[model samples]
Target: MTLELTPILTRLQNMLQGFLTAIPNILIGLIVFLLFVFISNLVRNAVHAIAERAGQPRGIALVFGRIASWAVLTLGLLVSLTIIIPTLTAASLFGALGVSGVAIGFAFKDIFQNLLAGLLILITRPFRIGDQIVSGNHEGTVEDIQVRATMLRTYDNRLVVIPNSELYTNRVVVNTALDKRRLSVNIGIGYGDDIAHAKEVILRELAQIDTVLKDPAPQVLVKELGDFSVNLDVRFWIDPPIRREANEAQDRVLETLKKALPAEGIDLPFPTQQVLFHDQTEETDGHRTRQREGWPSRGIERDPRPLREIRPNSEEVDNRS
Candidate 1:
């Protein structure tokens, strides 16, 4: 029995020897991986430097550089893996991954969409860092754009991170894109007041303000004739740098108008209803009496009696003729 076990041990030793001969392949795979990592790092640094020199924001540059570097490193890793294990060639790996890839993609669909949208935003550049923008219900200054989301600093100094997908699909209004913006305000005055004088006063107030542009000129139009007051639309052009000053300018303008109007004897009217009463007994024969003196009465009277009566037919004498 001892002699028979020796042959089986010899065969096991032969198999082990053959497997040990492939150890060099493992070392080569590790060397290739390290080389790829080094190359990827070098490329990433170079790209980051170029982007920085181009004046791109640090966050945006890092986003682009990291993405590019990782993409290259992933390809290198695949190659190394295939070399180590001959069964994992590109075609075979892709074919197998194709089935499971759909599942993984479905799980992270939103993330992928946001990533793509962010990339589109970086490329197209509809707005940039420090731009005041309003999208969906969010209004703020853009602080940075990442691979999956955009960061905004609100007026109240709160940080809001919004998904890039939503930002791309909705309407985006860039307030700072134009060199100038229009400021409009609706003001009301008493109906009987002089509109020309009111407009002149408004124009004068607007002219005194330093933020208001004089080239385009300020506009004053009578927008509507209200029941008790006249609506005046005041529109003025403002430079981009003066956006922060617009609110202050508006407040000052209103305050000035409020104080100036009364000095000029102009009245800012409020809503009011007037009612008139009449006495029916004071009416003459067929004429209705006026409700109030100098009220300028008009229209038909509300009388209930008939003006004349109709007579019955009497043709009996005509029938005999």
Candidate 2:
């Protein structure tokens, strides 16, 4: 029993002495790491200020600062680890990490993809904060763009978080990409209304609106002839192409046109259909030239009587024959 206990006591004594001997190194490493953390924060602030001064966007500046801070922190961590273990060099540490990084990358593939996509988006400047965009089923003002997701504030005041990967891969429409955007409205007038007069009236009314742009000039084109009326497309340009401004401009244009067109004797006609009834016994039956409703007159003319009047006359003619 004494012999067996002796080895256990000896191993415990060795461990204690080793721990005491390494205490100073441990303290030194801790102090160095803490100092490096403080220095990294200072570096982050300096980089942020410099980027902003260089005219970078706020998000781009922030990301650059964060990258610098992380690099500093990573270097400090390696130095601290080397201090704690004299045998561990930065090269050896990196070599070990290289093997593990593949597993980590697979484990967090989506996270890293979003991070890469976000970085590209910031660099490309496809859309900026406060810009209105439509992506998939989500459309709103971009409030903030983060490494993993983009924050959107919908027109109805709802918040939506979309993954950056999705935004980068899918098609996104930036409504405010240009300084001015064109808006079109279709208005139909009766066939009898003068096309030239209607176009003049629409263009004149559009010119009066303040939101509409004057340089490109407004246009009213005859689109197509419909069953009841002719469709005229009214197209104009507006500045500061935002949703609210566009809607307001459209509302004003519609109101002005609705009132101005009818007041000027231009008729806004609804769908009208003339239905005809025919009797097989009538003399005009199967005669394309004589039919008043189906076909146009081709030098042959006939008075169209009521179905009751034509039916009895046709039957009497048939009896006589």
Candidate closest to the true structure, highest lDDT? 2
The lDDT, on a scale of 0 to 1, for candidate 2 is 0.88
- Tens digit per residue, CA lDDT, model 2, 1-321: 345788889999999998998889889999999998999999989998999999999888877788888899999888989998888988999999999999999999999999999999999989988899999898899998888889999999999999999999999999999999999999999999999999998998998999899989998999999999999999999999999999999999999999999999999998899764555334565445544565444765544765456555555545544
Task: For residues 70-110, write the lDDT of model 1, one tens digit per residue.
Answer: 98799788878887886677999888889899999999999
**Cand. 1 TM to true fold:** 0.68
True lDDT of residue 189, candidate 1 = 93
Q: What is the TM-score of each candidate against the true structure?
A: 0.68, 0.78
Can you list the residue pairs that collide in candidate 1? none
Candidate 1, superposed: residue stretches over 4 Å from native: 1-45, 54-60, 72-98, 241-243, 277-296, 299-321
Q: What value does the lDDT take at residue 235 in candidate 1?
A: 91
